[model samples]
Target chain A: MSGSPGAGRSRIVTWAVVGLCLGLAGALAWAMLDLPAPSTRLPGQVAAQLERSGVEHPVTAVLLNFRGYDTLLEIAVLLLALLGMLAAGVAPRASAPLGASSMLAALARALAPLMVLVAGYLLWAGAFRPGGAFQAGAVLAAAGVLLRLAGFLPAWTRPGAALRMALAAGFALFLAIAALGLTEGALLRYPEPSAGALILAIESGLTFSLGLILAGLFLAGPELPRREDGGGTP
Target chain B: MSLGLFYALLGGGLFALGLAGLILRPHLLAKIIGFNVMGSGAFLVLVGLGSRDGVADPVPQAMVLTGIVVAVAATALALALARRLLELSGDMVLPGERLRPGEDDDADA
Candidate 1:
C-alpha cells in the first residue's frame, strides 16, 4: 500500500499529526496534576446531596435526579442518532428463516428470557445499587441483537407507528414531566415526596425507549416503504 | 506516581495510540475502532483522575456511563455511514479515487 510515490509525504503528515496529538495529550495530563482531587469538595457535596435526591445510590441520584437535564439531553442525542439513521434510509433486510438453525433458535429461546430477567433486575436495583436504565436497556438491546443474529426479525425493524411510539416514549415522558414542573417549580423539579417514584417512572420509560432504539440501531435494515396492510419488509 | 496517576498515564498513552491509529489508518473501519479506543481512553482518564482521593466520585462515574452509551451509538452511526459509503463507492477508504477503465467493473465483484 505504501508503494505509491507520495506515500512518504503522507507518512510524514501522519507522523506530524500523531506528534501534535501526543503533545496535546501530555499537556492535558500535566495540567490535570494541578487540579484538586476529585473527592475533595464538589464530589463530597454530591455524595451529601444524594440523600436529599431520594435515592441511595449516589450515581443513580446524580444521573436521574440531581443532573437529570443532562440525562434528558443524552437520551435526546441517542434518539436523534436513531432518527438520523432512519432518515438516511438504512433499514434492515429480512434475513433467511431461522428454522434451519435449530441450535441458534434454541440459544435465542434460552438466552432471551434470561436477558430480560436480568434487565428487569438491573432496572429495579438502580435505586440502591450500581445498575440503572442504561445498563438495563443495554441488556435488553443485547437480547434483541441476539435474536436478530439468530435470524429473527424484531417488530421494531419495521419502524411502524407503534415502534416509533416506543422509540419516542422516553423523551416524550421526560419532556412532559419537565413541562409539568414548569408550572409548579423549575423544569424537571420533582416533588420531594414523590421524587423517588418519579425517577423510577422516568427511568422505566427510558429503559423501554432506549432498548427499542438500540435494537433498531443494531438492525440497520434496507429501506422499506410502509405497507398499508401492516406487513413489514418482505 | 500514585495508582490513580499511573492509570491516568495509561489513559493518555491509549489516547495517543488511538489518535495515531485514527490519523494514520486509511480504512474507515479502523478509524471507527480508533475513535472508540479514544473514547474509552478518555473515560479511563476521567475515572482514574477522579478516584485520586480514595473515595470514588459518583458524578464522573455517571458521566462516564453516559459517555459509554453515547459512544456505542456514535460507533453504530459511523459504521452505518461507512457501510453506505462502501455500497455507493465500492471502496472502504475515503472517496475520490480515480479508477482505471476496468477497475470500476472489477470493484463490483
Candidate 2:
C-alpha cells in the first residue's frame, strides 16, 4: 500500500517504480512504432482475414478454430485459482446487508437473468462473433458481483463439495466433448455440422463454469479470514 | 504486438514490485497478499504474450492459462506450509527469519 509496500521501501524502490513505468511506456512505444504492419492485426483483423479466405464468420473462425483450446484452459485457470484460494485458507469476512440500496439491488437482479442470457448468446455466437466463453463468463461473474452488492448473495461462502462440482463441470463437459470428437477422429475434433456447433457446446459449459469460478475467486472470499465453513453465504 | 507488448511490460513491472513485497512484507498474511499480487501480475504477462496479430494464439494462451493454475497450486502449497508453521509456533514467521526458523515460530496469536 505504500510507495514500495514495505515499512521502508527506500529511494531505491521509488526509483524502481518510476523505472518500471518508463520501461513499460518504452515498450509500448516500440510496439506502436511499426503500426499498421500485417502482423499487428486485432481480433477483428484476423476475422477479416478469415472472411477474405472464405470463412463464413471471422469471429467464429478465430474463436472456435483459431484459439478454442486457449478458451478451454482459461476456464481451467479460473477453476484452479478458485480451488487454490480455498486451499490457502483465505476465507471471506462477513458482509453487511445491502441495506437501502434497493435500487442497485433491483437493477442487479433485473440484470442477472438478462446477463446470463447474453452470456448464453455470446457462447452460442462464439463460432461467428466477438463473444466467447471468456466474455460470457466474465459477464456472469459480474452478475454475481451485482447480486452480492445487492445483498442477494452472501459476501463469502465456505468452499465445499458444491463448489468443487461447479468448478469441475467445465472440465468434465470438455472431456465429454473431446471424447465425442474422438469417436469421429482425434480428441476435440468435430466432423459434424460445423465448428460453430462444436464451439457452442463447449462454450455453454465454459460460460457457466468459468463465470462461477472467477466470481468465487474474486468476490466470494474475504480479504483476510472468515467464520463458518460452507453455506449459502448470502 | 502493440497492446500485448504493452500489457506484458506493465505486468512484468507489477510482478517485480510484488516480488519485492513478498520479500519485504514481514507479516505472514501480508506476504500471501504479495504473493497473490505477484501471481496476478504474472498471469497478465502470460496473457499478453499469448496475444497474436489478427489471430488469437491458442497454444500460448492455453499454456499461460495452465500456468496460472499451476501458480495457484504452488501458492496453495506455500500457504499450507505457512499455516503449519504458524500452528506449530503460535506465531507467524517473518520473511528474514530464514536462518532462525524455530525462534520466530514461538510468537502467540
Top-scoring candidate (TM-score): 1
Give the winner by DockQ: 1
The TM-score values for the models, in the order shown, are 0.86, 0.58
lDDT of 2 at A179: 75
lDDT of 1 by residue, A1-234 (tens): 467756667668867998898897887788667766433465778877777787889899989887888899989999988887766654344334333155766788789899999999999999999999999999999999887765555444347788788899999998888777786669988888888888898999989988888887887666333323332222
Chain A only: TM-score per candidate: 0.85, 0.69
Model 1: fraction of the reference interface contacts it also forms: 0.56
**Distance (Å) between predicted and true CA of A193, model 1?**
0.2
* Local accuracy by lDDT, each model: 0.79, 0.60
Across B15-67, the per-residue lDDT of candidate 1 in tens digits comes to 87898878766678878999888888899888888776666878888899899
Say which docking band candidate 1 falls in. acceptable
**Candidate 2 off by > 4 Å:** A1-63, A90-100, A155-163, A219-234, B1-94, B97-109
State the lDDT at A20 in candidate 2.
69
Query: Which pairs in model 1 have colliding backbones?
Result: A91-A221, A91-A222, A92-A221, A92-A222
DockQ of each: 0.48, 0.14
lDDT of 2 by residue, B1-109 (tens): 4577567667776676676656654567667878888777777766665562434554445445445555644564566556646656655765445322232353233
